[model samples]
Target chain A: MSVLSLISGASIPVQLVMAILLLASLFSWYYIFLKVFTLRRAEKQTAEFERQFWSGADLTDLFQRAVNARDSAGSLERIFESGFREFTKHRREPGTDVGALMDSTRRAMRATYQREMDKLESSLSFLASVGSVSPYVGLLGTVWGIMNSFRGLANVGQATLSHVAPGIAEALIATAIGLFAAIPAVVAYNRFAGDVNRLAIRFDSFTEEFSNILQRQVH
Target chain B: MAAAAIHSRDEALAGGLALAMHVLFLVLLVFGVSWQHKQADTAVIVDLWRDLPSVTPPRVEPPPPPPEVKPEPPKPVPKVEAKPPPKPEPAPVVKPDIALKEKQDRERKLKEQQEAAEKKKLAAEKAREAELEKKKRAEAEALKQKQAAEAEAKRVAAEQQKARDALAAQQAAAQAKVVDEYKRQISAKIRRFIVLPPNVSDAAQVEFEITVLPGGEVLGAKLRRAANSTPAYDAAVERAILRAQPLPLPPDPALMRQFRELNLVFRPKD
Candidate 1:
């Protein structure tokens, strides 16, 4: 039987299930695309910002640059700006201890790091849910279809293959569509999750390295 | 700062490109897969039985040979009187000449009678055989003629039946067309007379049976179903059908049978 026939011949529940799966697949794809672009940009911007930070530019000048171009600043650059801003604010206090000042700067940077990570992790859960649950939804539709087809057999005196084949084919379509919805989502989720994790690690290491530089400058 | 601004612009451009790519991929997948599936669906399924070799007809058993007629046995030849003791050499001194000549003549006459009887019996046997052969030939000719007549009658009857069937189908089709045309005309006339209240929001349908006379006169009208609960609407529909008096009907009396008890449904639209 043709795909069209399989879809049209499916029971109402099966059709509804297929429709839901299709919508899920579409949304997953949209997120998959948007995340890919966002993650890649974050990585590139982090690398560029790191190169600029280490190019012997004065810390005060770098902080000014980050603030002036705040809208376009990378996540790593924003962390540096917040930490440096706190450092300069505390330094003007005549009796501020170096240890306490360093603590406040680290706290500010850590807060910014988490907010950026949260942005990166956004929508990853949705993709994971789609990947894991769509197949079961499709399975539910298939089971319903098969049950209906078998129930219909009670009306017949003798069941033949032709009588059962179309129903089964229609039922199987739900599973096929479910798998279609699931496979891509699962793949995209795994790949994006790995990318986000790697970016988070890079951001964490940059924060530590920047704090070490500040410690030396304070001395 | 300038570098960060430029990087952001690049990021936005990359996102736009990625979205376009995905949209393109989606369109291709939907159209490509469905189109391929449709092509596969159109494939023709050939019945293997259609190509099977033709079957030979079963052999018919030959008829049993005709009963053999036995020829009558020839009659036995009658015995001739033992030739009178070869005329004993009659001595000229013992018998008179007249007596000797009379005795020889009597012997010849008896031999002739025996030969004539033998020839007559042979002729009678030949005549009986000829009569039997003639009777067999006549019976065979009569049977052949009877079988030919029967086959001809069957063929003629089949042809006549086929012609009658074709004529009946043609008549039925023509009558149906006439009935449909008349029904359309009647509906159109009734539709012109129907009037619905302007405030009614929904379309309404009224089903009723109308009885008509042979000359296209409306004899009675009865409402069978009404979509709305309003009695006025049902009554209005009944009145419209009645006003369309002498519902258009085919002139053919035979076609009148259909219109005699017709079920009419009216759906009034704005």
Candidate 2:
């Protein structure tokens, strides 16, 4: 028999671990790829929305789209939907005090803004989990392999270099694989997570600016 | 008035959040894919461990037998055997002729001289003739007895010689047959015990030192080689040996003694 064949007979556990790690890596990369496109599109949309909002386009048309065709609406439009709906409802009610109307509408918009923020943060935690934990998981597998190797050596009367080498080498492979699976996830997680936070701040400021615009329209 | 302003700001914030959420999900996917690629690479390495060292002794042609030497015949030595001289032939004895006329005259004269001086001499000669006739009869009887004894001795010698020749031939044939059969059975048993692996392509020689008992029961197996200590490959090899228990034993009682401890090689060949 050739030397090559003897080395490649993989057992079940190693295969399993490798499969799992591969799955996780694939998921993370998929997430990264999908996020890259999504983030780019969102950025473009926000820029377009800001440009249109500041331009002289009619507010009624925008509001109708925000209310009726939500697909075209951004987070800004949803916030407008909440506050405008409440404002309109109050204005139509008989004997409704003006102060109460504005207060309630403002509160409603604020709540919607918080909801949208939560939505943005969804699945971000999962990325964090993968990034933070994968390396350690790989470490665990490596350690387990090494422990098994050592235990096997106990039965041997005189352990030689080759005897220990293969086991140790196998054990180390798990760690290397784990680290390989983890590093990119962490980097992507951090970068994407920061982007989410920054976008959130922009959303908060836009809500304030839109509220000021709404006040002008009411007066 | 504040409510209208607040509405616009809230809408803006909501739009920004939607954008951010999309980005986050995309990031997760990329990371997941990269991790998957790395994991696949690891799985391949584990496969390498399994395939490297096949545990079988490779088949090769047996070494050519040493050249035969033709020995020279020894020189002939001369044997000296001297021939003895031939014995002389015995002379035939002549019988005295009896005449009728001579018998009558002699009888008459004998009667006349019976009481005279010549009578004693005549009586002595007659007594001698009677004694000679008795001796001739005794000699004839002894000769017949000697011939009968010689015949009996020849028959006994012939029977003894035939029995000895038959016994020698039977013993030689029996011994040769027994030796040949014993050799044949032992060869078959040793050949039968060799095991080939399931897949031959990636098969390797996995050598083990195994100890067996006289009863064909395996006592122990020790791994002499590991292709790679990867858990997958190593565990599989050990399990294969255990599964191959109860090694082949020689048929003859005496031949079985030769297999108490031996080294076996496993090569997985299709």
Candidate 3:
């Protein structure tokens, strides 16, 4: 029998398990591509904004451009814009305490950083869950299918390889598909997770340096 | 704005690529497996050498009897009659034509020599008339010797002709016997496969004209006529003929040609 016929001929639970793995694999692949593009753009934008900020560009000029950019600003740019806007607002208000002003500005940047991290880390948990769970689901189907085949063997007077082979083969397809679904999800999850972590670290260091620059401006 | 729009649009592209990839994977799996199955189907090889080497006992039977009977008969014929000539005769019984040509050529040369001697005798008689009576007696003796030699050659030629006729008859008889023996062997082999029908008479016989290949495979078996028998018996005989594929025939191809198409009569009791 062909693999397709064998798969179609499998017991209901096994087929269900296969269907789940296939869907999980497809979704993982989609999330993988989505995260790739999202992280790539985030990294490129961070590099570009960092270069511009450090290029001896005027703070007020960069702030005006970032404000004009608004909803379309990158993660790091949005963080910079929010901090600078808060700094400007407190500076315009007379008798505002310098330490409190710096504290509120850092708070604003921290909130923006949290939002950016959320966007970069989106769908990552789903990838991690699929990678961890699919193999077990496939194993469960295989075990159940093998149990059913052996149960069927009780009625037959002679138990032969031919009697048991198709069932075992069908059952094993679940495990094969399970590994198929899990391997890439695991690999992509590991790679993308590392990338997001590195970006997170870069954002953290940027916030610290930005807060220091703001304190100097206040003095 | 462009970057944000492009980023938002990429989900569709990613989903399409993922779906296309899965479809490509499935096509590879399905076709790859089927291609492998096809390769396995074509790999099965039938060894013809297995069939060719085991020349069965029946195939060994027909050739020896003909050669043994054929060579023995002709040997005694030449030994009995050609003893008087004492000439070095090399198997004249087997090769009568060559021996006959050699004898004729020798006789011609003897006659030419006699003619030359007669001419010389006449010339000498004219030259010496007193010795004419002696020359006539000598010529008469030479004529007597020539007549005896001619008679001897005629007797030998006649004996050779008689031996040839006997040898041809013996060969014909041997061939007929081998053909009959092969027919019996074929009938016996077919009979082994016959499933005798119940209530069929021992007298009932079915005749079939069967065509066979060189390898003894029965190409076709046709009922020449329905025996005064039931259809079940006819079917039994037909099945038997088919089962007895490659019916036993003489190994000699010349003899085998006689068996290519045979009208076989099968009787249940026989």
Candidate 4:
């Protein structure tokens, strides 16, 4: 059977499966692109913030800059600003101990790091689901299509290969489409997950280093 | 700030490129454009070595039995009675010499007769032996000729059989081809004649058998099987078969026999 006929001749259930797989593939690709852009931006902004923070810029100036950027501030810069703001706020209170100031600052930085990691890891689960489930869905369609073809065979007095082949080819198309949807999603998910993990590690290390620096200031 | 703007623009560009690539991929898939690979046509290689006909050698005829030798009858011998010595020669002292000379002459004649008889018997024995040798040679020659004739006859018969087998095979293949063509023509003619009733909406198949004469006239048509169809549907199919009269048959009488009784199936929804 020709590829055109295989697809056009598919039964209703198989066609529906193919349509769902195509949509899933399209959306997975979109997320893949979006996540790539988001991760790259996050990495770039983190690097830029690190460079500025270590350039011997005054702490107050860096904090003011981060505050000015508001929601647009990078995750690392936001963590720095939040911790510094908490330190300053508690410092103004009479009889505030150095231990309490450091505790509050570290806690705030840790919370921001968690929020940043969550944002970076968003939409990855969808890619994972697409990769894992599409094949079975396609399999379901293929089984149904084959059952229908065999059912047709029962009506025929003599079953020739020509009678059954087109139906089978149409059925197999679903599996092909399923694999088409799955392979790329699986590969992209793996790569993105690794990238997000690396970013998370960087954020954790940055928070620890910032806490140590603040601890030195308190002394 | 400039870096931020460039970064956002780059993000937008990446997203746009990704979207464009995905769209292109999906379009290629739906249109079945990118999956084209040159499918190499498989060449069918016939093995002539195995298909060559094997030639069988003719059977050898056994040698003919030896000719019987017949004994010749003995020739009749002539009998001579000894004559009584008639009168003893009266002793005549004077004629003794004459008597002795006569006896000597008689003994010499007898010896000459016995030698002639012995020579005649030897010549007859030699002639008999020569005749026996000639008969043996003639028999051998006749046997060789007979065997050669038998072998020639066998070889001719085998060749004739092979030719007949080849002809039969060729005829069968041609007959099959003609039958297929005849079936196709009949189907086309029937389909052309058929005007399906509009009210018959269900998917139905009407199978019927048609009997045609050698001259291509439709003798009779009867419905063999009916499925999801009414009597009207069956009647229409039968009528169509009848209308396609004389039903294009192969010109060969042998091939025409195939269409004499034919089972045809008609599917309304096909």
Candidate 2: where are CA atoms >4 Å away? Answer: A1-15, B1-74, B77-270
Best by lDDT: 3
Question: With candidate 3 superimposed using the best TM-score fit, by how many Å does residue B100's alpha carbon deviate from the native?
Answer: 99
| Candidate 1: residue B49 Cα off by (Å) | 25
Q: Which should have the higher lDDT, number 3 or number 4?
A: 3
Q: Against the true two-chain complex, what DockQ does each candidate achieve?
A: 0.07, 0.02, 0.27, 0.10
Best-first order by lDDT: 3, 4, 1, 2
Q: Provide the overall lDDT of each model, using Cα atoms, as 2-decimal numbers.
A: 0.77, 0.60, 0.82, 0.78
RMSD (Å) of each candidate, 1 decimal = 20.9, 29.3, 24.2, 21.6
Comparing candidate 1 with candidate 3, which one achieves the higher DockQ? Answer: 3
lDDT of 1 by residue, B1-270 (tens): 365565566556645664675567556655667433334456686423222222222233333333333333333334333332233343344256677676676566657655666666666666666666666666676667667666766666676677667666666766776677678778878878878755554667778899898867788998888876366667777888889886766656766778899888877662
Maximum-DockQ candidate: 3
Residue B250, candidate 1: Cα error in Å is 67
The residue-by-residue lDDT of candidate 4 on B98-143, one tens digit each, is 7777667656755666676666667667766776676777677667
TM-score of 1: 0.50
- Name the runs in model 3 displaced over 4 angstroms: B2-4, B33-270
Determine which window of 10 residues in candidate 3 chain B has minimal summed lDDT. Answer: B65-74
Model 2 C-alpha lDDT per residue in residues A65-144, reported as the tens digit of each score: 67775654566667778887877788788887757877888898899888877766665676677788777777776677
Q: Classify candidate 4 by CAPRI docking class.
A: incorrect
Where is model 1 chain A poorest over a 10-residue stretch in terms of lDDT? Answer: A1-10
For candidate 3, the TM-score is 0.52
